[model samples]
Target chain A: MIPAKFDYIKASSLGEALTLLQEHGDEAKILSGGHSLIPSMKLRLATPSVLIDIGGISEMNTITEEGDEIVIGANCTHHQIATSDLVREHVNILSQAALCIGDIQVRNRGTLGGSLAHADPASDYPATVLACEATIVAEGKDGKRTIGANDFFQALFLTALQDDEIITAIRFPKVSQGTYQKFFQSASRFAVVGVAAIKKGDGVQIGVTGVSGVPFRATAVENAYDGTSSAAKHAMDGVDDIISDHFADEEYRSHLARVYVKRALEAL
Target chain B: MNISITINGKLVTHDIEPRISLSHFLREHLDLTGTHIGCDTSGCGACTVTLDGQAVKSCTVLAVQADGSEVTTIEGMAQGDQMHPIQEAFREHHGLQCGFCTPGMVMTAADILKNNPNPTEEEIRHGLEGNFCRCTGYHNIVKSIQHAAEQMKA
Candidate 1:
């Protein structure tokens, strides 16, 4: 499947990427690992006139600590996140989710920033990020600003990113206990229904993905959680609009959401 | 656009379209047909290859994206007709059927062995999740990788 012809530029810096994006307006798409974008392009589902290849911007790839948060560069691949000692120590749930993203090949090339920016409803990171209350930083011609995970994901593949914006980094506070559980789609390896649950301070936080048009925090499930299966059974009490796919019907997806939530919460 | 990359330890550059996938570039332009392509959507890992020492699906990567990096395809595994140990193990264990998925399986297995010189059956299976083989039911593939691990360790 050949992607449509388009002009390509490898940005040497974040500034260059932003400038190219600003100049091209809505016609420019930023390329990170190309794991997500390239596949979409090959399908002809996306036809951007210009490809701003940001994969070469080495400065945007780092995992570090700042104050109380663990900062991860957007260009950091799933394999990096899955194997990073800092990520494993700081937020094990993120590593666990990264580990299960696809097979070894996918993990080696898929980028965290790209995954979050692409904002696929079936993607794994949004669930853990929403559960952990991570902050996403977006940089543009003006400056950089942070978006809460809950607000970052809008719907489907939609995000709050402006055409010129680029995700620079995502930061998460150190967490002691967290887990991601999912029923996977065999072929794409995407989640059929996934849950990320974390014990944060006095309460349990949970996020549900692949069962909605967007990945969302299941506050109802979090409040109903009592370390028991009954709480998970009632997880969908307040949530509406469960998604159905060829792989699983709505009823099954809802059921898996509750089942996985139970397993994740119980694991935590 | 123009890009340069090292494949099989040889440096090559070309003026190419931005849309050309790495799998196509390797097979068509470089004639390294040992790297196969199946389900270019990243589902089938038949196009697996080493990029900077990490296995990635060539179908999911652009030739332009691989610029300035080192790539290792199945063709690069052997030296002067001496098959790579993993290749030898595959033959000895009858690791392949139809042979469409061998190049990719071997590449991914190379990556697994590089990270974990000796892996348990479960680990080998886990590492092979991306590389699908519709034949052999994966029993012999696992055995082949197990044998390769022992041979590499020896």
Candidate 2:
């Protein structure tokens, strides 16, 4: 099936892309790798009037280390992050999650920024990022501002990013150890139930995906495990309100969440 | 819009609509029909190609987004009349039956082998989570990739 007609403009720089977005506002969509947007466009689910291709901006494709955090440009492909030495060293769980995103092809073309901006509830990186407590940097006509991972994903396919704002980069703090486990749906390969756990000092932050509108922390489980190993065992005692529709129902996902949370905690 | 790209080691330029996918640009514009378009949605990997040395679903990529990039398709995998090792292994191991998903499967496997020279059988299965083959039940495809990995390592 062919997509609806649209105008395409390849912007060479961020300023140029921002100007295009400011001009078109919600009517204009930024095309990075187009792994998520183009497919939706082909299905007529998202038909924008103008597509500003920001893929040519070299600055948006970099992965760098800044002091205590790793700053990844929004355009960095899953392949880039999965194979980067720095990411493997400091945040290996992110790389592990990146490697499990899709098939070889999807990882090569899909960008971290694009995935985060799309904010799919089942996306792998969102839970990993949320577990790592990453920060999303957004730029627009009003300049740049940072949003915490907790507040970044607002709803399903929704983000705190303004209509004219573009996600510039995502910054992740260094952690001692982290692990991501995903139960992928057979057909789409999205996370039917994914758990990302990070060991920070004396506590653990557990992020759950594919069971909610947005990737959210399993605070009930966190509170349970606050200072004991029994926390891992009894993590899913009170998180019944988080699960939703998809490949698995609330009961099954809750069960998987309990299993994965225990496994993730044991691994850490 | 006018876009110039390096496809399968050759430089080609074309005028395309903003909505024209890279898969269509290759099949329709350049006539490189080896890259099959199985699903218009990105769920299927039948339109897989190597973009800048990494496998990507061409159906999900816009031609304009591929500007200044290098693309390699199944047609570029072989040299002259010789089939690529992965293609040869697929034929020997009976990796395909209907052949509709062969090209994309081979390309996706080739990309996986390039990254993981010694992938485990489990890794091979997990790596191919994106590309689906309705035929063969994936037993022989796994064997084909395992054989190709050994051959490539040799």
Best by TM-score: 1
TM-score of 1: 0.98
Report the lDDT tens digits of candidate 2 across residue range A150-186: 9998887889999989999999998779999989887
Note the residue pairs that clash in candidate 1: none
TM-score of each: 0.98, 0.94
The native-contact fractions of the candidates, in order shown, are 0.98, 0.94
Please tell me what DockQ candidate 1 reaches.
0.91
lDDT of 1 by residue, B84-149 (tens): 999999999999999999999999999999999989999999999998887745898899999999
lDDT scores in order: 0.90, 0.86
- What tens digits encode model 1's per-residue C-alpha lDDT throughout A1-268? 9999899999999999999999999999999888778888988989998999888888889999887789999999999999999999988899999998988998988899999999888999999999999999999987999998889998788998888799999999888999899888987789998898899776799888889888888888777766665678766776777788789988988888888988887787
Query: Which candidate achieves the best DockQ against the true structure?
Result: 1
Cα error, candidate 2, residue A129 (Å) = 2.0
What CAPRI grade goes to candidate 2? high
The reply for model 1, stretches above 4 Å from the true place, is A227-229
lDDT of 1 at A145: 96
